[model samples]
Target: MKNLFLLLLFVGYSQAASACDCLMTPVRQHIKSTPYLLKGKVIAVLDDKNKEGRDYHLFLRSIGIQDTVSRGYSVKIIVQQDFKGKYKAGKIIEIHSTYSNCDMLFSAGETYILFLHKAQGNLFPTYCSYSNILDGSPASIDLVQAIRTELKSRD
Candidate 1:
């Protein structure tokens, strides 16, 4: 009986630990699927009341995405109002995900590549998206180029 109980406990813990199993898709595919994608630094993070009267952390000027159809126009990416954490200003982080287990996580002053999607007129990043810290890898470079290419093609 003791052994069985121990086994069950271990199994439960393992499952909980592995809850966020993300199957990463190719960067190009992510670009094609998401409406907004860009790279920028977080300018500010504020604690404020959301529209629903609920308390949430607002990432101010979180990141800037340029309008594909309009030159010299940019869209400011504000993290969804449900996010709960402290994000320091001037941190460069990538956002890729759809509000699932893979939500936004940032370290101050770190550069990242982000993948953003449009949902109900708001942009969100999830853990499942192909976003990561900028490690100067060829794959990261390729992703940046791909995003640039796709944006240009839309013009």
Candidate 2:
């Protein structure tokens, strides 16, 4: 009976550990399926709570956001380059990210290659995507080159 209990405990732990595990998708396939892909530096991080109130409601309604209220923080990023999307360089854009364990959180002053999806006029990165910090490593350089090559081939 004790051994059986131990086995069940292990099973539950394993499932929880892999709850947010994401399968690696090929770069080309991931790029093709994802909507927005950009490299940017996070300029600021703001608490989403500050956006509450009447003006915020009006803004959300104008933007067609009816029910979804993200309880996470807003990350403002300065667009350094856009690999997939046509976001203009030097422009600052705000993207929302939840505090959930499965989502990638943005930090100020750090650049990242974002694989973003748009929902209700908002952009966010998923943990399963190829979105990663741009730390100027060889692997990052190679990935960026691969993305560039793929984009050129399509052009």
Candidate 3:
């Protein structure tokens, strides 16, 4: 029983670690950019959208970073999932996408990722991973959980 428990723990950790590594580096540093990149620790999770099915924000914290300078590189990451309506806030998940728009403060010319820790007010939940996205993490396909699929821009 002990051995089996340890094995499961190892596998789960290994998967998370790999996921984190996947989104730890900047885009310029890599030769080929993968779709999923960001990975981080979950801080909080909450839905900042109203019933109008218009507003949606997912907040997350950085689990891949060594130290958080200020707000832990908190970002309003965007999710692009066909079945986004199924996901709920506070579900510490991983994201697989590129930084479409950035404040240029933390990530400017880099292709990093953010892990889903918790949901912030409007930002939802996000963790800016300047490294690799967590391995065996939630499908990197969904960028951000949006109530609506059609949109002009995303963070």
Candidate 4:
């Protein structure tokens, strides 16, 4: 009986750990699917409590918790370069993101590549997408180059 209990406990823990698993999309595919893909620096981070307060609630089902624990954050970014979007350079835009495990937490003064989706007149990014901080690393450079190549091909 004890062995069976231990096995069940392990299984439950495994499920919880795998709750936020993300299958990152390839750059080419992400470019095609994402509505706004821009590289910019975050200028401000504020609570999303304006007209569209609490965009959505993420429910984690692993631990059987049925409460909406995460709130949305609005990140203001200054467009330095427009990779694939209507926003021109030097324009400031606000993107709504959640603090859930499967979402992004933006910080002020950090540069990031945003793979945004338009929903209800708001732009947001999912944790499973190719959006991430641009830290001048090889992975960041590779992604930017891939986006550039794909955009040129489309043109």
lDDT of 4 by residue, 1-155 (tens): 99999989987886676466877667788899887889999998776444333333322334454335555668889998888879888999988855555667667899998888887888888457888899899999998899899999999
lDDT of each: 0.47, 0.76, 0.31, 0.77
Ranking of all predicted structures according to TM-score, beginning with the best and ending with the worst? 4, 2, 1, 3
Tens-place lDDT digits, model 2, residues 21-140 = 778888999889888889999998777336753345435544445525646667899999988776878989988865444656567899999888887888888568788888899989
**Candidate that would win on TM-score:** 4
Candidate 3 per-residue lDDT over residues 53-124, each given as its tens digit: 112211221222222222222333333221223334333343222221221222322222332223332232
Model 4 scores a TM of: 0.73
lDDT of 1 by residue, 83-149 (tens): 1133334333333222222345544444555665555554455447766655679987876677667
- Stretches of model 2 off by over 4 angstroms after superposition: 1-19, 48-70
Candidate 2: RMSD to truth: 8.7
Error of 2 at 104 (Å): 0.9
Error of 3 at 144 (Å): 15
For residue 1, model 2's alpha carbon misses the true position, in angstroms, by: 26
- TM accuracy, model 2: 0.72
In model 3, state the lDDT of residue 11.
68
